[model samples]
Target: MREVFQQELREVQDRLVEIAELVAISIDKATRAFNESDVSLAEEVIAEDPRIDQATVALDELAITILARQQPVARDLRIVVSALRISASLERMGDLSTHISQLARYRFPDKVVPKSLRSTFAEMGALDVEIANKLTSLLRSEDVQLAEEIRNEDDKVDALHLSVFDKVLGEKWKGEAVDTVDATLASRYHERFADHAVAIAKMVQYLATGDWDQSAA
Candidate 1:
């Protein structure tokens, strides 16, 4: 029975990694769609979000089953609890990516980001992808170092988000209301996606160290 329970734990970890990979792909494609105004790619990202949602739901059910059947204690309990939290975070991250793609689709042939902020959006997208890829690695390896690196990448995303606001509000800003709204919304989605990644990484770090620091960097 103990061995079987251990196997279940491993399975949960594997599922989390799978979700991470899918989210990475979603963000990558969504970013491209936003940058290039590729409605097809945007639609693809939107359509695939249901898969990520299903995976999270399934993983949560499995974790609850283990908790009821095995009544995991100590580190085992921590693992199950953390799995639930991380799964939730990953699901939100997927939704954020979908939101970004939706913005692209809304604007259609015209780019969501204006020419003035194209470079900033591009950098944000690239960093979002980088942080997502790091999350996959962190899930697979459970390396605390990788978790910290993910947080650092998130900081960069946050900085870029602030920059977007600065440009939009600057006196030199000449974008239409719709353009400003789209830029604000899209930048927020990207920033939130990175924030979710950081949240997941912190949970992983907690699982490894057994040190639950709510103030984790």
Candidate 2:
């Protein structure tokens, strides 16, 4: 029984790594679609989002089954619980990537943001992609240093998010109302993607350090 339970726990970690890999691919493609106005890539991201959703649902069910069968305690319990929360965050990150692609699809041949803000959005998108990739590594290796790096990148995303607002609200702004709305939504999507990555990193860090404070979440 002990051997079987340990195997189940390893399975949980493996599934998480799989889901994180999907999220990394998602953000990569979504950001490219957003930057290049590639409707086909955008469509791909939207279509594949269901896979991320399904993966998360399956992981949640597996975690619940482990909880019921093994009645995990102490660190074992934390592993199962954190897996659930981390899966949720990864799913949200996937959704945000879909949202970014949706914006690109909506804009179609037209760029999502005006020339003035394109570079900023591009920078934010790159940071989000980097964060997602780092998150996947952190999950697989349990490297707490990656978690801090994720947080730092998230701060950069937040700064860019605010800059988007500042530009749109500034008197010099010349974009149409539609452009304003699109820029705001896209920036938000990018920022939130990084935020979810940070959340997952914190959960992983806490799990590794045995500092399982609920507040770490």
Candidate 3:
């Protein structure tokens, strides 16, 4: 890669990292909005989503321009293509978080999510945070091993998602109606946010090892 192409690619990479960080914070805030029923926080998450969306679009355009002008090959090509796809996923994850936040407004603020399902949501929130941290680590360390570990890390979020469903249904089975269905739907959104982080990890792994794995889906 020429110096100019390398410089452009670096700029795209940095912008993508910015998008990831913003979306990660959005996910965290959205999860809290659901758990605590804080409409202000949910609204904030929704409001900030456009930042991620715009960043993704700008970064993608720059990347595409680089691909057209430079015609990079091998590692340089992988980095640009991977970053483009990663940015798209991050933007979608931001949208998912905003969707979750919107759902929390379906009911009154005083209403609490069922006690049986709260723990699972709490766990999912922590896992989402951890998954975000892991992606940050991958960027810093370029650790393929750590990136691969992210797939396993995502399973923890999946488990939490499943457990929330189980708890909600189990409570419903015990004659407790699901009055707060919003949180249940919100839990799935958080779970998908973690899933996007896993997609980034898979791309990171491919960047390092050139192995294609559809299992991240």
Candidate 4:
């Protein structure tokens, strides 16, 4: 029974990692759509949400199966529970990425968008990709220290957001104020993207130590 339970745990975890990887790709594709001014890619990210949703459901089923069949006890119970919570967080991250894609479709077609801000948006997108990739690594390693590193790394995205805001939301924008809306939404997307990354890290930490901290990082 012990060995069987352990095998189930490994299978669930591996599937969790796979789910994380696909969501990361969704984020990257959505960001790329923004940078490249490609509406098709943006639509692709939005369409991918069903996959994330399906994965979340599948994970829940796996956890329930373990709970019913093997009767997980103590630590095993906690890990299985954490797996459900982590999958939900991962699904939210996927939704946030889709939000970015939707914004790109809203703004880019009219050519009112400034050419100068492209690099800043690209930087934001790149940071989001990094966050997603790091979370994927954390999915496998589940190391507390590495999770801290990802939490700390969020500052970069925040700084990039500030820089974009200072430049675009100004008198020097010279009545080109519609861009403000674009910048504001972009800032929010990146900020929330980093927040979800940190959330995943926290979930991993909980799985490892059986100690979950809401205030973590």
TM-score of each: 0.97, 0.97, 0.89, 0.88
**51-102 in candidate 2: lDDT tens per residue?**
9999999999999999999999988898899999999999999999999999
Look at candidate 3 and tell me the lDDT of residue 60. Answer: 87
Tens digits of per-residue lDDT for model 1, 94-168: 999999999999999788878999999999999999999999999999999999898888899999999999999
- After superposing candidate 4, which stretches have Cα over 4 Å from the reference? 110-113, 175-177
lDDT of 3 by residue, 1-217 (tens): 5999978976876787777788778878877887788989989998999888889889989988998999999888889888888888888888998887787655546544666667777788777877777786776566988786778888888887887777666645442344446656667777788888888888888777878787743
Q: Give each model's clash number.
A: 0, 0, 0, 0
TM-score for candidate 3, please give it.
0.89
Q: State which candidate, 2 or 4, has the greater TM-score.
A: 2
Worst 10 residues of 1 by lDDT: 208-217
Better of 3 and 4 by TM-score: 3
Give Cα-based local distance difference scores for all models: 0.93, 0.93, 0.78, 0.82
| Pairs that collide, model 4 | none
The runs of at least 3 residues in candidate 2 whose Cα sits more than 4 Å from the true structure, single-residue gaps closed, are: 212-215
TM-score of 2: 0.97
> What lDDT tens digits, residue by residue, belong to model 4 across residues 1-217?
8999899999999988999899889989988887777888889999989999999999999999999999887878878887887888888888888888888787666532477777877887888888888888888888678788787778888888888778776656643657778777777887888887887788788778878697743
